[model samples]
Target: MKLPYAEIEFDDTGERVHPGQVKDAASVISREKATDVIVICHGWNNTAAQARDLYTRVVESMHMVQGEVPGAASRRMVVIGVLWPSIQWADDVDSGAGAGVADEQETLQDMIRARIDDASVADRLVELVPRLEASSTAQEQFVALLRKTLPASTEGEDEAAFEMLATGDVGEVLSAAKGGTDAPDALAAAGGAAGIDPMGVAPLDDGGGAGFFDSIMGAGRNLLNLTTYYTMKERAGAVGRNGVAKALEALHDAAPDARLHLVGHSFGGRAVTAAALATSAKVSSLSLLQAAYSHFGMADDWDGTGKDGAFEKVPSRIDGPIIVTFTRNDKAVGVAYPIASRLARQIGAGLGDQQDPYGGIGRNGALKTAASLPAGTLLDVGGAYAFEAGRVSSLNGDAFISGHSDITGRQVAYAVLTAVATGRS
Candidate 1:
């Protein structure tokens, strides 16, 4: 099917794979005389087909529910989808040997070799994978190599990432990666519960022979998952700040009078937020769906040490309301963020929930922003929203958002359309 939207592709280094594609998209928006442009970005672990499907479904949903908002159905808006080189977080470890013995090892090896910048570190890490569960020395070596492989943390929230990597006990690293068992309901919602399970790895302990994550290989898989989490985080930031930001500017240059609305899911959320901060164009609104960023990511002073979030200036740059959809049902961010929190030494129950210092924006909502961000529910289709310009609204999506990828529903589309319309004069 011929998609309704144009696409901008980016490489791993944040360079445009096809620069003319962006320029062409810009020309179309200008030629079409669009009044508003909505740029949607997909998060990590998506294939090219998956990314296209995401854009297709989301745009379809928006079109299906545009009438819910006043003037939305008649709005002159153009859609642009972003495609970056984002890999799966735990594809290697998720299937384990059950996926295939030689194939599993080869896949893990290929992933490690591709992601880790240092050849020596990647080789050593891959060699140690086989012994991670049985040998303490192998586990220790794996952790040390990973510590060396990852770039040094520069943010206040990431201060403990290296510390977690530097641990001598592989079990502690695994436990940290496990992110504790504080919220059983979230796990159930993830597919272990009574409803949808988008993550597919939610029910780790279903009492079925120690489950997959409890096995010896599963222990090793935990460390691999942690490594990819950090790797993808860095890659997403690069693609957004350097690639998407430039695209937004190009779109603005081509159509200076058009209003720009940014929408991103998971790591794409981090990317678009970074783009908003870097671009000179005036952004009308931002819709972050289950964003895989820190809850403290936009705070001016989350630590009280005078340090701010990585994207602390984002809210100031957005001209309209910053709409964030979050829920405890998202196991992707729920599991990963708590590992980061545990690295920061914020252990115990509720590690990835709203109160944790290192909780994810997707798992909770916009937290510790400079302004007092209001909290509300992610209303149903045709529901009313009292969104104010230049403020942040955290929408509780536990009722509607069943998983991380549940952003393409009519209800979510309505909320996004409402956000775009709120920016209209």
Candidate 2:
């Protein structure tokens, strides 16, 4: 279905694809005399169509629960859907499904093509994949190429560990990926919850020795996924901080009286938060659905090292409550964050779980922030919430948020509306 809301898109470098769309969406607010502007951002989608579908589902769910929010019936709200160049990993790339070695090599090639923008670099990377299982020289060259292709990013908590991508032993890094999280059962649980087969990683020793190149091929795939995770994370932040922030500023100037509500899913959550941090736009509410960022992203001093989180200033910028949803059912964030820790050389049994210092916000919740309020689990459609303004509320969505992409549910819509209502003067 075509997106009913105004659409704004950005390129990989955070430049607006169509600069006029921001003004056009702002004009929409003025024409409709919208009292509120709901901006929804999508994360890590392969195509514009998938992103549009997400926006449609979210708006549909919100319409169904608007009545439950006080004063929502009288509100005239216009929606904006933000799109960016985000890529999704191929299922088999991480799953390590029991496919033949030739099939696995082909799968790795497909993954490289999907995530890497430069065709030549991606082709070179693909060539290295087959050799990964047999040659250390090929392994070194692959890691170097991967590091050189990715954009320079400063989003991680450990700069030294992140720098290891460039300077550390290439062999050890790939080995860490081989020893990374093995969670087919976790994926199964997530799939069961979502009623769909979840993306996952299978053990290399799953019988028959798999193949001669199985273990090294698995390591290459995992490294690719890990690097892709960080790449998308940085790209999302750039898009939000520059393009989305500019759009919202334009909208705010055009419709000064309208309250702005920002809602984002996955990496989009980081985008919206980054946009809010960058712009002077007066945001009334924020709803982050299964966001993929550090659990300590908003923390003032998560490890007592006197260092603040990357988004330490976000909570104060919003005038209303920031509602963040988290769940264990999200295998994407679950598996990715642990690999992130492993890449950073931080090892622990609970690497990606809530107890881990390196957990993603979607797997756990916003942690160590001064604005954090009493935590609550995500509620049913008609359930009540005591969301307070100028605070951060971490709502557990384990009961309802079955998977990473399962954020367009009725319960989530209700929570968003409730937060918006709570922000009203």
Candidate 3:
């Protein structure tokens, strides 16, 4: 994700990557042109180093799998890291004005603004990018930019910047600045669908399920959904699951074979599922990690085994499969059932440990809606964060990877990719 050496801009204080900066990164990603684009949305309260570590771990595994190693094939996934300035609140940090969190953020922002102040610094940054794979480099630059701009950006400002980047405007700006807008601009110009509202705040009940996010994780669930909606609309402006539906007619014309692969953690898994269904079956695969499929109603009803009325209509939409990953020890699911109970007012169903009649849960403890997926189709993961732990959340509670936030766990990434690529029941 590193921008072209000539495309990056810098200043005396720091180098700031506005919307235009992402085009270079996107070009790098699109150049890889993998069948499955593993879109990663980091959990809340993650440090720059933490995000890097997590990203590398998965990427390395992907590379290994590509080499016929025990890991997943990175080539199969076009890595897209959604870098938003949404603060992942760690309970350990004080939230008051002048706390260490605020101070550190301010410091980070200063470092960036300062780095961009030097003359030729922007030009020199061009060295950071080459005509090659750069997801890691781009992310580091993005992290640096985040640190530098955190102070200047509000929640909305940060989100707007991310929207710009995701929708291809950032790359357009950068490509135009570089005096060459062929690749970046062309990619940016690719039209797509838009309009997808995030699942607003709702109470979460820790009902001791197998695949939902626990209450302890930070607010990553809603943050992802909100950002996702805005990005989709900005990118395509057509064809979404709900709220907004503006399809990217140009996408159909540009990358005819290209399809979307969505992997959601915890409740975000639920969001991914709903979002995917909204598409015209253009999605290749869906991986739900410990997600809570709340469309059926509330917590009490989850264990009741009642039929998921509206949800039942989803599986038939896309030709792809659905994979749900969860674990018996995960406390995240414990939180989801109660939440479903309170809201839907119906008794929840089972923890999905044994079997959810729906379909698609891997032996790794994931729930699957499709036993076998299309050749290019991905799995739809549901329940809580089945394989991992508390990592991301929203205003109500934590969700992404219901069990734990350490997506870098030994077999977690393996299990996820294996289930998706293989589509084993």
The most accurate candidate by TM-score is 2
Model 1, CA-based lDDT: 0.73
lDDT of 3 by residue, 259-295 (tens): 5455554333444454554555355455555443332
Q: Root-mean-square deviation of each candidate, in angstroms?
A: 5.4, 5.1, 18.8
Looking at model 2, residue 42 earns an lDDT score of 91
Q: Pick the lDDT winner.
A: 2
TM-score of each: 0.84, 0.90, 0.42
Candidate 1 local lDDT, residue 417? 85
Residue 173 error for model 1, in Å?
A: 3.1
- Report the C-alpha lDDT of model 2 over 291-379, residue by residue, as the tens digit: 87888888888878798988888888988889999987787776565555555656454557766677888878888889899779999
Alpha-carbon runs more than 4 Å astray in model 1: 1-4, 90-130, 166-175, 178-216
Model 2: number of backbone collisions: 0
What is the model-wide C-alpha lDDT for candidate 2?
Answer: 0.77
lDDT of each: 0.73, 0.77, 0.32
Candidate order by TM-score, decreasing, is 2, 1, 3
